[model samples]
Target chain A: SQQGEEDPQALSIQEGENATMNCSYKTSINNLQWYRQNSGRGLVHLILIRSNEREKHSGRLRVTLDTSKKSSSLLITASRAADTASYFCATDPFTDKLIFGTGTRLQVFP
Target chain B: EAGVAQSPRYKIIEKRQSVAFWCNPISGHATLYWYQQILGQGPKLLIQFQNNGVVDDSQLPKDRFSAERLKGVDSTLKIQPAKLEDSAVYLCASSLDIGAVAGANVLTFGAGSRLTVL
Candidate 1:
């Protein structure tokens, strides 16, 4: 069974706009990670936010975690055309295994 | 360092036939995983190995699917009598270990093998 589900299944925005995607999981997690995948390629790890941490930032990517609500959100600021891809949120639910979300498809139009 | 490597980027087989995909994880990585990703959906964990030992195969269809990680390094996943529903991308991922240490369990995925069953 899937442990996480992402909202806004698909989003299209201008290259300079920001894109935000939300994820909700069913159980408690030790950490939440975000990844990006280009078409026909493997996924690339973006950032990971531990349950104890409320938010994290890397480059233009900002990830916020709300353990109390079992939710997380990823924000890509000053998005670029290269940022167009599928984004996923994976949760490590007290185990070594990481369960992934349904993913959000973000398209940046130039 | 080189990333995870997978073989046969694409494959096409008729239903009831057999097919196999190979994966070579990053050197020194001890944990490897196989996931099946159907179109427009999230990847589902099929099997996980911790240094040649099976840690989880709960979601694997043991009846037709099998996998092995020899010498705790390279791995192979095989499907006998494949079905049309088996058409999807097989993704291989690996991590240093299953350790609980923060920021150490990130998985590095391969390009994946896309299989098409007719």
Candidate 2:
């Protein structure tokens, strides 16, 4: 079963703008990770944050985790048309298995 | 290293028919996973394999869906009597031993099998 839920089912923005996606999960988690999927393609690993970590950054992506609230957010700075895709948040609930959320679809127009 | 590989990029069959999907994980990877993704929804794990043994099959529909990893290298997922609701993309993924290490659980996904059940 899916454990995470993402807010803002869809988002539209212009290239060079910033985009943010949020995810919320029920129950405690061992860690949280984000993934991206292009149209008709498999998912790609974006980043992961352990339960003890609060914030992490990679390239133009920033992920913040608040275990107290069982929530996490992904920020994409300077978005691009190429960045247009669906983003998903997955949770590892100590079972060593990742359960994904509904996902957020981001559309960036050039 | 080569990434995970899946067969039959797409398939179309009527309800009650049978279909099978194959997956070959990256060389030496000890973990394999299968997920089902309906349109506009996130991928849901159907089963997971650690080596040639089953780790989790709680979400799998055992009545119609089954999977196996014989040599701990390649795996197959089969639906004996497909249902219309089973029309979705079946994704295969692989990763290192998840429990053996904390940072080795990042998954590498395959291109996925697009199954259309009419």
Candidate 3:
């Protein structure tokens, strides 16, 4: 079963705008990682945030983790058409297995 | 360094037929994992290997699915009598293990092999 659940199943925005996706998990985790997948392709790891960290940034990506609420969010600023893809959150909860969320489909129109 | 490699980007086979996919992880990676991802869903772990030994296969269907990672580098996953529900992408991932330390768990995944059961 999937331990993480992403909200805003689908989102659409114009190019140069910002997009935000949220994920919630059921258990404590050692880390939460985000990935992006193009259509019919493999996933690309974006960023990873440790449980003790509250926020981290990578270029245009910003991720926030709140262990108390068991939730996390990924923000993509200055979105572009090429940024259209599915974003997934993977939770590593004291196990080797990474439980992934359903994912958020973001479409950035140029 | 080269990323994880997988063969036969796509495969289409009839039901009840057998199919196999091969994967070679990046050099020096001691941990390997196989995951099955269905369309519109997240990937699920099928099995995991630490070196040449099985670390986890709790989710694998022993009846028709089997995997081997001999020599602790390359691995293969085989499915016999494939079912309609087995049509999905098989992803291989690997991570480095440094001296039995439990902190090195980040995984680098391959492009994956897509299977279509007819």
Query: Best-fitting candidate, measured by lDDT?
Result: 2
- lDDT string, candidate 1, B76-108, tens digits: 999999999999999999999887355447999
TM-score of each: 0.98, 0.98, 0.96
Of 2 and 3, which scores higher on DockQ? 2
Interface RMSD of 3: 2.3
Those runs of model 1 whose alpha carbons end farther than 4 Å from true positions after fitting are none
DockQ scores for all predicted structures: 0.73, 0.78, 0.59
| Native-to-model Cα distance after best TM-score fit, residue A7 in candidate 1, in Å | 0.8
Q: Tens digit of lDDT per residue, candidate 2, span B1-118? A: 8988999999999999999999999998899999999999999999999999999999999999999999999999999899999999999999988765655388999999999999
Candidates 1 and 3: which is better by DockQ?
1
RMSD of each: 0.9, 0.9, 1.5
Model 3: DockQ vs. true structure: 0.59
Could you give me the TM-score of model 2 versus the true structure? 0.98
Q: List the residue pairs that clash in candidate 3.
A: none
Of the candidates shown, which would achieve the greatest DockQ relative to the real structure?
A: 2
User: Chain B TM-score in candidate 1, rounded to 2 decimals?
Assistant: 0.96
Q: In angstroms, give how far residue B13 of model 2 lies from its true place.
A: 0.6
